[model samples]
Target: MNIPSLPPPVTRDKNALVLFSGGQDSTTCLAWALTHYNHVETVGFSYGQRHAVELEGRPRILEKLRQFSEKWNRRLGADHIVDLSLISHLSETAMTTEMEIRVMENGLPNTFVPGRNLMFLTAAAMLAYRRDLNTLVGGMCETDFSGYPDCRDDAVKALQVALNIGMDTRLALLTPLMWKNKKETWQMAFDLGGQKLIELIVSETHTCYIGEHNRLHEWGYGCGKCPACLLRKRGFMEYQSEKKPI
Candidate 1:
């Protein structure tokens, strides 16, 4: 694999907690955290999403990462599942409710659960405080996304500042995929842990907004029509195209 130039390896004493959702981007972010941080923990949210199937794969993905290598097994730490069910009550978006996925008059996808990432980070920050983790990592991306304002880099950075000020602690918020599109994300997985990680991502992670897992596609098990599945599929195709012989 042709790996891109990456940031310097994190110091062994630096600890991080990843916001893992068992989706393609989050899973890749988990792997990225594992590759960089010394001690890495994970936190997932139970937001009553329509596609809650991703939650079921969280433990399995973590276990597989543990088994992938001795180093990862040693570095991986505790996992936290936060109950943010209030999000479902607050919003009737397609992500939180059973509704057709489409863009609203606001020109944003109805799948945008307002303040979801903000809340996720807030909860993750609280957990990190208790766990003494200083860095918080997420898969939020702006390069190839559904135009969700919360996923923007500025929002994440501002949140980090607010979190640190509110808690009176310096908590670094890291978004590895902030500028990277999906194809680069796939290449990142391959670079981080080789074909095994790519295989793990393709087979184990869930990204469909509809919770469809029985039917498998080249990218993974998804409805293949939803925005999430479409992005994953296109990224996988681009990634594979680059790998083919000229």
Candidate 2:
């Protein structure tokens, strides 16, 4: 798949709160926010995901990120974790349950937790409002992803508008990875913080849906078969190939 050229980085003099999940994409977004914003904070949701191991990796990733540079250490701010376990009660999708990962009759994956991203963004927006952060950053992407309707660009943009109008405040919802494929996402982490960031991501970040973190893979700690793991593995392979001699 041909990934489109990334737009120029958007710098904000104020602050941004990233919707961080301690996965590859969210880790990259946190780095991007630290690089572009004056102050960067992170917010994670505890929605009783089967892969809740990612939650444990959050602080470890953040601490390691602080060591990347003095500037980032200074810019990185407090981290917030929201208790959204209600999602498990509200939905019985594969993400919140132990059901086999398969396609539903409606054509969407059983992994598609209904309104997961929507609730995430809404909660993040509310947190941003309280924290006085004007910008909201997330790793949501339409390219190289599961066919989740919520991850689509249109849905995110509409939610952004709704969020701002409902709150009566101008909040900039930024999806830096909205168009980039997983390969391009790998490149993005490299661009933001180089090899060290990539190493940290591969060693520390968690992306497995089945909560497998003890078994490590070249791309990261995953089962290397789930949709999330497969995507990450494929992207890393492509990224490595691109860096090789022609």
Candidate No. with top lDDT: 1
User: Per-residue CA lDDT of candidate 2, range 107-193, in tens?
Assistant: 988999899999999999899889988888989999998999989888887887788669987888889999999999999999999
Clash count, one per candidate: 0, 0
Where's the lowest-lDDT run of ten residues in candidate 1?
A: 1-10
Give the C-alpha miss distance for residue 217 in model 1, angstroms.
0.7
Candidate 1 global CA lDDT score: 0.90
Clashing pairs in 1: none
Candidate 1 at residue 106, lDDT? 93
Q: Per-residue lDDT tens digits of candidate 1, residues 1-246?
A: 222222322544788999999999999999988988889999999989988999999999999999988989999999999999999999999998888999899999999999999999999999999998888999999999999999988888788778777998878889999999899999999989989998999899999998999998878999999999999999999999997453
**Regions of candidate 1 where Cα sits further than 4 Å from its true position:** 1-12, 244-246
Evaluated at residue 66, the lDDT of candidate 1 is 99
Off by over 4 Å in 2: 1-12, 244-246
Which pairs clash inside model 2?
none
